[model samples]
Target chain A: MSGKPVIVFDKVSLYVEGRRFLDRADLVVSEGESLVVAGAGGCGKSFVLRLILGLPGMGRASVRVEGDVVVDGHSILAEPLPALQRRRRNMGSVMSGGGLIENMDVRKNIALPLNYHYGNVMSTAEIEARCDAILGDMELEELALPGRRPVSLNRMERIYVALARALVNQPNILLIDEPTTGVSAAAGERLARFCFYYRPEFPSAPAAMEEMSGRPMTRIITTVELEPYLDFGHRFALLANGKIEEIGDREAVLGSADPNVRELLSRSRKVASPGVDDADSAELPPGGGSCWRRSDSHWCHQGDRVKEGEEGASGRTAQAR
Target chain B: MTALIGPIQGLGAQVCEAFTNAWSLLMFSVDSVAAVARFFSRQGFWAAFRVSLQQVHFTGLEALPFLSLLSLLIGFTVIVQSLPQLQGMGAHGLIGKILVISIVRELGPIVTAMIVITRSGTAMAAEMATNRISGQVEALEAMGIDVFHYLIAPRVIGSMVSLFCMVIYFDVIALVGGFLVASTQLTMPWILYSDYILESLQPLDLYISLSKSILFGFVITLFSCYHGLRAKRAPYEVPMVARSGVIQAMFFVFVSSAVISAVFYWI
Candidate 1:
């Protein structure tokens, strides 16, 4: 990770409906780094992403922020609407459950940002070309046809489309919330890879990653389950009791004392070791390949199920390192 | 004293709530006007203009047939009722004056506004509420697109244009239809009828009718959008907001039209 900080959460606290959701949380993510924040369901995991985007929470309850959230050296809480809009232009966000416009089809949804921002400068053909390129990169060219609204797509397809929309702008920073919520574990891994890494096999992969400054896109991904992002994230943080209990490198987070952290680690371990817990391994399909494997000095996992024995799982983990 | 205290407290609370709502609505109106100015001055003019055109098509064009029928019926009724009464009073020459005063100055703008409120105003509110509940509005904000520029401004402009055009259409159909229907009963020349209406019509009458149309348009749309966006997230809130929007828009259209008429004619 680079030393230049792209996002800084300086002792931030958020209260909704007179109840504390975040308590003096401090997080600093540098340029070109991906941070995975893991928490249980309803623990305000999505709220963090909304906070970065300067959005109100889901319901009508009043929300109050006690501390500053600085993104790209600008204090988002203090900025005017126009300044915030300008800042948002440089950042891409994938909301939970794929917040696509319902009336517009998939093509229009993805083309929205480009059309709104560059419609005056770029021709319609050029705009469509950029949208087509991003859709191709996300392997969603088939769904790019008109009349394919978000409601028509499955969860995985919707998330992929949301990703394509987020990346079409070539934003410098990306904020994703629960990308792998309802999809299978294998699909989740692929989605995570698409967010963080650029594969050479995809023709427009460079277009997705190519910012104006030529630096890697900074990403902050929030998930309820840690297994999906374990391989790709540069650092991991455990959120519990309205605070980030543990945040560090993957090894440091894995070795932290937080019970939530421990539970997630144990759950990941069970997924990595198949026969060790047959009950948990049920999520793995019968003819599926081994979920856990060694790849590029990382523990790349397919499914969130534990399949092999502890010895085999540890051996793979050791090899992965 | 204790019993009176409870009632007084409740009344005070209601008053406070009313004031709060009024203040909120006033602020929203100011923000909406400012957003329109900013939208025109900004970069996404054509994109937002396309949305404005679509709104015009939906709000103005689609309602044309219904408006035409209603205007013709109203025109025939007014002329049929008033011409005989004027002839009996030996004031047959006042046909044009009566038509201009009743239809052009009042009924044309008010009735057209009522139709738009029933049709387009409710739709705008419900659509905006649904978009909010579905997270589309939040998504638009996250994408750096101004909600006011893309959504509110287009709807406001479209409603104003639609109401203005519809009022004129209503007035013409009412006058012409009234004259045609009355001619069958009274044996009056078409030229005489036409001359009477043209003579009775004044620039002041036109100004009042057009002003009411534009004001009614602005009030209806602004109220609908304000109520619709008040919906936070729940699915059930959609209908509730839509109903509130329609009620408030109707109320404001009546009140504002009355106030404007009173200012122009009575005061």
Candidate 2:
């Protein structure tokens, strides 16, 4: 919490296909604190990740980055692709839907970033050793082998493999999107714990490897669900209708007058309460009441989904607001 | 008046889009050239070397049989279509000269380019587009790998080398096919036909043929990469870009062939 800011989005606006996706958004995350950006579907969470990654130029439509996005105290938009790519390496991303390169097997997918960064300098044996250590830390020794294809793996296995790939390079900033969409609730909570406090401290790992992985990282994670991540982060940012509606310490914002914030909290309460039915959950948006907080760091399942609890929760939250 | 304004505005937008596409294509070309130069140092020599070898296999070796077949068919058709008129005029001696001029100097390069455009160029565009949509391209960029150097430069260089080799293959098959047909049907001597064909093939013709093949190869790969990069972030855009990429590549091939042919033959 005492570290300097690692990421800064200053009045950034993004317009895609003649429709504004993000409007003058601003946010800052200090080193070593995970910031969860919660928003509904189509609320620019994905665009925010792409924008910070400086991906506006790669698409067909004209991309205009109106303001500054500084990561590690440098202007990412001002730099070109090759330069931007180098800067991007300092950050790791677990893409939505697990963007494993289909052509490469699980081991190669994990080894790709390392090979890219250290291919020129490191010996092949050294790279393999690093990859082995990373695999061990993620506890993926048995399920994923060097030759196992990504498609052959189950959903939870893919998420774990993707997590290994994102952490392989020991990036200073880790970006994850919708980390719990396809996995069991228990698996989701375990993955979230790893994201929050991952340090490569395996006994078999080399000292230098430990040193590289032990550095403080600034993590930025985006999810549609609020309860699973409610008390997991030092700060929270709520995005609604193409704008950051609220951003503050978790408790303050939870208790804020913002209608969106109140709605999110009440939705969390409904999800946490037992006996919610699927029919009610179907009416809400994706990740609406399907997740809730168990304690300070763990996420627990409340119901199959919110069914009868939807109307009651809405009425209660509206009265509270 | 409103109708006229709407049409005018649409036309203006089209013109603007055309210029923008042209500019983007030019920039992509420059970036690709730079990536090629930087490949050895930035991407490492062995990685680029392996990719180049793979491309040679994909674009050249795998395409050999098809190119050979097409060239043979064209050679046979041209000779057969002209056989009656040449026999009546007692002008069998000119058959070799016609083959060398039409098949070797022109058809060999253009046909090879066309086949390559249809096969490898479209595949490369679709592959790149799929990679883009599937987040593989972004993954590469995120990992600090230069997508241009890693994905594009090797393919372009590989296609150029492959097209250059295929032109030789096309020329040999066409001329040999024409020679066999002439010898059997027209009772022409092998030594005489060879001598006549060799005599007709000027150094300029050889230069033009090789140059055209290389230029066509470069244009096709460039257009494919440009269009593939232009594809929007949707699965449907993959096919759309692939189709447009093929069209643009063919258009450039024909246009460049005309310009080069005019400069060599007419000018």
Candidate 3:
């Protein structure tokens, strides 16, 4: 870990309507370390991420985010509401559904947090450039509107736009929800790996960076994903029933005989690994989410059975290398 | 370090949004009306009253000159058009009385409502629509400001006060116009015109017009405010709400005007 633990969830327990969501969960996400949380649906994967993101605090009291979620030595749980919100500006969040405003045009939607939170000091022209720069990174310069409606964009397009908004500020930590559920597995894995590819955006507008008040750095505090969706992580953690059952390097986690972790990975509705884009099962063959596609078998097209990277399906790379 | 980018600018934009929203709120009768109930329900009377005064000034007071001009034309046209008919029937002496009845009983109330509808009615609908889409309504709640008290009540009060003043203004202008046109265009002596005015209207005619204006004002403001407060979620809902506010406001104005006219006739 490059720095002391940025977010620590110590003995946190959460229950909703009598269903135990998170039970005495203890977790630590360090700065710049990618801690992938792997679990099946309803296995409290999202709950773990939300805990670190501080989502539960909006309503309940029993579900406590204990320990210290200290970012750069500032503990959020200790700060006042206003101060916490101010600190929240350093953290970027994109919910699984890509919480894009459907009514607003793309440019306006992305610009909202920046414009609204920043106020009006940056002129329209300057803000537009910031949006344009982020749009370029995803090679989505033509696929979307900087100022068009969210509903008009495709699912993946919406996801990228959501990502663009989240990363635009180059925040201290990013808390992302399900990014692989709706899109193709190849596309999904690439989306997660894309984070590994982006370096610090140093050469852009200094005016925007001035607002951030520190060295230009991009960090990934943690990622909540199931075993099937785990792509690139320094370590993987098993989140079962609100508590992290086991956390270790990939080999250790894979080798552990913990029934809780094995049952989670085995019985879990296994999704394809985002890192491996096998070509045999790419295509859907007209109308099928067939067994192969359903259970970790990567496909090229919707059902074509050809190479998964048929040059245009977003998984345009050899996986078995 | 990154949080303080556009502090001054963001606040400026919010203020801009607020004022524009307020301006639109005053433009429609329904919005103004809802703003009334919203005011009392949310804000104490004192705060609402001050906002109402501001609304009255912008919506009703500012509209006076135009209302006066329209009313004057109605008055002159009534005398001129009716003069030929009355003179042909050898009832030329009754021009004054006809002018008085038309101006006081019909033209005054209807014209005032029309002006208020065109100006204020549309404004409120647009404001409400914008607030719905922009999350300004939510911002209000977060800030401990009651959207109803802060936005709607004052509008209703303002619309009523403005509409009332407009009716009076329209009535006076029409009477003056009628007298000027009758004496000059008809070449009738001043004494004849004066006598005609006295003969055409009963004192009760003034009461009927005032009552009609009050009813129209209330209905117009109520409906406008209602539409504004009920802004829907969709973007398309905004224009729809605005159109509905004006249509509903005008409908009530006509209905009230007719009812008041009927009561005057029976009396």
DockQ (CA atoms), all models: 0.58, 0.34, 0.04
Shift of residue B41 alpha carbon in model 1, Å: 1.3
Error of 1 at B105 (Å): 0.9
Fnat of every candidate, listed in order: 0.74, 0.47, 0.00
Angstrom error of the Cα, residue B179, model 2: value is 3.3
Off by over 4 Å in 1: A198-213, A253-257, A265-321
Q: In model 2 chain A, where is the ten-residue run with the lowest total lDDT?
A: A286-295
TM-score per candidate, chains pooled:
0.88, 0.81, 0.51
Which ten residues in a row are the worst by lDDT in model 1 chain B?
Answer: B35-44
In Å, residue B5's CA in model 3 sits off its true spot by: 60
For model 3, the docking class works out as incorrect
lDDT of 3 by residue, A1-321 (tens): 455577777676776545677777777666556666666677666655555544552222245443444455665456654455555556666655566655457776565555544433555676677777666655666745544677678877777777777666556666666665566655765565444334224244445446663533333323333443333556667766566765676567668788766764563333456545454333212111111221133222233333443434444343211
lDDT per residue (tens digit) for residues A1-321 in model 2: 667887888888888777787788888778777788888777778777776777754446666668888887888888876678777766788878778888778887887776666666666776677667766655577755657898798876777777778877677778887787665544555566566555443234334344545557777788777665654566778888667654676667667887767766554422322333324433422222113333222222333232233535543221111
Per-residue lDDT of A129-199 in model 1, one digit per residue for the tens?
87777666555678988788788899888887888888776787888998877765545555666666532
CA lDDT, every model vs. true structure? 0.78, 0.73, 0.61
RMSD of 1: 6.6
Better of 1 and 2 by DockQ: 1
